[model samples]
Target: MRGNIIVRIEHDCQDLPPERRSDLVTRRLRFLSDAEILDLASRRERQYPGRNLHPVSITLPADVLERLQRLQGSRWSVSALIDRILTDSGKA
Candidate 1:
């Protein structure tokens, strides 16, 4: 089976002058060819294996996130730090 192609556009043109913004709207944008799209999709599928790992999102206060990042420093990842804390507390 084949998957559908989805395109997303992200830009920071809000600060541009009205004339430039209009020009940007009328400008031609490049898109990936079908082969390129399929290749990228296949590569990403192989890059991320979705078997044992689950994804979770949590929002923390700015100060807390800053503290976490400081703790992460060079050796640990945010996930590793959180996992270690949970494991030590008998929560994980």
Candidate 2:
């Protein structure tokens, strides 16, 4: 689990008030120790094989890079945002 794990919390907590979302995430995260999380994640990988990601380097003009960084915002990684763009355009 070297990369990101997008855990979409779509269970009973989905209907909770927006104000309670942070508390829910905090409580759920606190319930697992680092080692336990790693163990469970390893087990999951064994159970369901998925695509592996590798790093790629790309150079962009300063203005384009700045715009991409701004569009990335706080919720998404640059890689994720690029993936989304490609996927939406049927290129990924």
Candidate 3:
């Protein structure tokens, strides 16, 4: 659950005193429990489909990059599409 939700909350009230913190906060939340926590527990695999998945950097020739762009889908992410192609070709 902790890994699924990565929150980076920034606030300007840190410099202010404790009594004045709430006055400048944008909003507040109070809940007994959240349904999202339960959903996250069941959503591990869908988050990352396979093992050894990580980022890489490479320089492809302009012609090759342009050709790969044609196969990229509008909805599918560029990296995911490339990964599928590489996996199918047994290169990954």
Which numbered prediction scores highest in lDDT against the true structure?
Answer: 2
lDDT per residue (tens digit) for residues 1-92 in model 2: 11222332112323344334333333333454544433333311234345454443333334334444343334445454333333333323
Order the numbered candidates by TM-score, best leading.
Answer: 1, 2, 3
**Candidate 2: TM-score?**
0.35
What shift in Å separates residue 79 of candidate 1 from its native position after superposition? 0.7
lDDT for each of the candidates? 0.32, 0.36, 0.30
For model 1, how does the per-residue alpha-carbon lDDT over 7-85 read when each residue is reduced to its tens digit?
A: 2212222344534422222221113343432332221123445434323333343434344434323433444333333
Error of 3 at 4 (Å): 29
Instruction: Identify the superior model by TM-score, candidate 1 or candidate 3.
Output: 1
Over 1-92, each residue of candidate 3 has an lDDT whose tens digit, in order, gives: 01111112222223344333221111111111223212221222345444444443333434434433443334334344333333333334
Worst 10 residues of 1 by lDDT: 1-10
As a whole number from 0 to 100, the lDDT of residue 16 in candidate 1 is 45
Q: Name the lDDT of candidate 1.
A: 0.32
Cα displacement (Å) at residue 66, model 1: 1.0
Clashing residue pairs, backbone N/CA/C < 3 A, model 2 = none
Question: What C-alpha root-mean-square deviation, in Å, does candidate 2 show against the real structure?
Answer: 15.5
What TM-score does each of the candidates earn? 0.36, 0.35, 0.33
Flag regions of model 2 displaced more than 4 Å: 1-51, 71-74
